[model samples]
Target: MPLLDVKNLSVNFNTLEGTVRAVQGVSFSLKKREIIGIVGESGCGKSVTVRSILRLIPMPPGEISEGRIMFNGENLLALDQKRLRGIRGSNISMIFQEPMTSLNPVFTIGNQISETFKVHQKMNKQRARKATINILEKVSIPSPEKRFEEYPHQLSGGMRQRVMIAIALACQPKLLIADEPTTALDMTVQAQILDLMLQLSDQFDTSILLITHDLGIVAQTASKVIVMYAGKIIETGSVSSIFKHPFHPYTIGLIKSLPRMGLRSQYGKKPLHEIPGIVPSMNENISGCWFAPRCDQSMDICRKVAPLQKYIDSDHSVSCWLFN
Candidate 1:
């Protein structure tokens, strides 16, 4: 069985304006020790989907309106708070996008990291502190002993991010959800962080769900890719297949938007390609295909009837009227 299976998951938010259907029928599977990338624009629900897997969404405003999240033969959606807590840090861990906000300002780095070990591994305070220092060193944090007493605000962005990674890896979880882990870092630091994550994944045999808007990062790290638009997955395939032969118009647009190494000189200062039009708001009741309004190849059917995912080959699938 796959390490994680998200089936027909839908997430909604109740706001003053209206109910926002943020995630719509999103489904994917992550195999053992494989890295899967979820890529899309800002409001495409990539973060929401991953947060839902961990039951992190606040119920008063947000809800898992439909579907199941199965991890290791257990349905996370069906689990109680106590049961879910048991699985959260020990079995599945998440590295959120922003470290400053995610980390507690009042707690020392060692306290926070050691808390994971204390709660999940049942380690004593001293043992947990030792383990926390070990994790800090593993993530290549210099002067782990000194940094242990530092608060989140005291560190640089890169260093703060490394501390977050250390906490996430404290328990050696089977699955790791990294949501834009390299955001706001310099190119060099970003590369280093990615390399560290790859090394850790190899050492721990961890299955990673990497959520990011950068296709370049996806190309570098993921084996399979899921392209989401307007809270729905539009295309999915092996990384090479999606990169080389994108079948959906939305996927094609996204790939084209990337600045190629040689294409810049060929264009001679021409503007980079952009996917025209903005992503539709979740509160807007979009009929038929959500991408139809922006799709160049959209037809009458695309505006009237939503297309189901159509398999092109053993590994590639696209949701579009053209495929139908």
Candidate 2:
């Protein structure tokens, strides 16, 4: 069985305006020790999808309206709170975006990291502290011993991110969800972080769900890719397949939008390509395909009926009327 299976998952938010469908019929799976990248623009349901896997979406305001999240032969959405809690840190860990907000301002780095060990591994304070220091060093944090006593606000952006990585990998989880882990970092630091994550994944034999808007990072790290747009997964394939022959217009647009090296104008300036039109608001009831309005290759059928996912080959699938 695949390590993680998300099948036809849909999420909705109950708001004053209306019921906003944040995620719609999203499905994918991660194999053992594999890295899968979910790429999309902001508010495209990438984060909400992963958060639902962890049962983190608050109820009343938000709900998992349909579908199943299967992990290790169990339905995660069906698990009790206590049972799910047991699986969260030890079995599946997450490195949330924005370390400053995710990390507790009052707690020392050591305290926070060690707490994972204490709670999951049942280690004593001394042993947990030692383990925390080792994890810090593993992530290439400078002066691990000194940084242990520092709070989140005291560290640089890169250092704070490293600490978050340390905490997430504290128990050597079987699955790791990194939501835009390299956001707001310099190119050099971002590369370092990605390398560190791959190294740790190798060491721990962990499967990763990497969520990011940056396709460059996806190309560098992920073996497979899932392209999401307007709360739906528009395409999925191996990294090579998606990069080489993107079947969906949305996927094509994203790949074309990447800034190419040495492809500059007469003035020695490279023009970056952009997909025109904005992502539709979730609050509104969308008709036909969510991407129909923005798709350059859209047809009359595209605006009248939603396209089902069609196989381009054994490894590639795209949801577009062109394939249909």
Candidate 3:
């Protein structure tokens, strides 16, 4: 069985104007010791999809209308808050996108990391301190013993991110969800962090649910790729199939949009291509295919009737009129 299985997940946000469908019927399964990348532009529901797995989105404004997040053969969505809390950092951990803000400014780094051990393992201060320093050391934080005493502000951006990873690993969870984990870092640092995550996952035998907007990052790190648009999954397949035989126009546009470094303009800037037209607003009903408005190859059927997901191969699936 898959280590983590998320199926037919839909999340909506209630607003004064109307209900905003942030995620729509998204489904996928993850295996232990594997990396799956969810790739899309901003506002594509990638973040919200993962957030629902842990029941992180607040109610009143946010609601998980329908979904099943099966982790280790248990339904995570059905679990109450207390039960969910027990699983959040121990069975499945999240390393959020922003490290500078995610860390509690009022607490020392050691205090923040130690909280998990104290709460879950009921470890004494001495043991928690040792585990905290060991986790920091595992993530390559320098002089972890002393760094543990420092506040979040004292560390650089990269170091702060390492601290975030350290906290996520406090319990050595079986699955790790990294939401844009390497965002805003330099290229060298980004590569190092990504490589480190894969290495650690292999070392600990954990699965990874990687969410990122950078296709280049996905191309490098993902064994499988899920392409989402607006609030729905439009395409999914192995990295090779998504790269070589992308059937959906949105996926094609994204691949084409990647800047080719070898092909530079006279000005020495890489000539980047762009997909014209912004993503359509969700104000009106999302009839037919949501991407039809932005698709260059959109047809009458694409604009008027929604396309159901079609299987192209055993492992490749796409939702587009062209594929049918």
lDDT of each structure? 0.92, 0.92, 0.89
lDDT of 2: 0.92
Q: Model 2, range 83-177, lDDT digits (tens) per residue?
A: 99989888999998797899999999999999999998899999999999999999999899999999999998888889988988989999999
Displacement of residue 319 (Cα, Å) in model 2 is 0.5
lDDT, candidate 3, equals 0.89
Full ranking by TM-score:
1, 2, 3
Task: Give a tens-digit lDDT track for model 1, residues 1-324.
Answer: 999999999999999999999999999999999999999999999999999999898997999989998899999999999999999888999988787899999999999999999999999999998999999999999999999999999999889889988988889999999999998788999999999999998899899999999999999999999999989999999999999999999899888887788776776767767777899999999789999998888899988888999999999999999988
Q: How close is each model in CA RMSD to the real structure?
A: 1.1, 1.5, 1.9
Q: Write the per-residue lDDT of candidate 3 for residues 111-171, one digit (tens) a residue.
A: 9999999988899999999999988889999899899889999998889888888878778
- TM-scores of the models, in the given order? 0.97, 0.96, 0.96
TM-score head-to-head 1 vs 3, winner: 1
In model 1, the clashing pairs are none
Candidate 2 regions off by >4 Å? 265-274
For model 2 the TM-score comes to 0.96
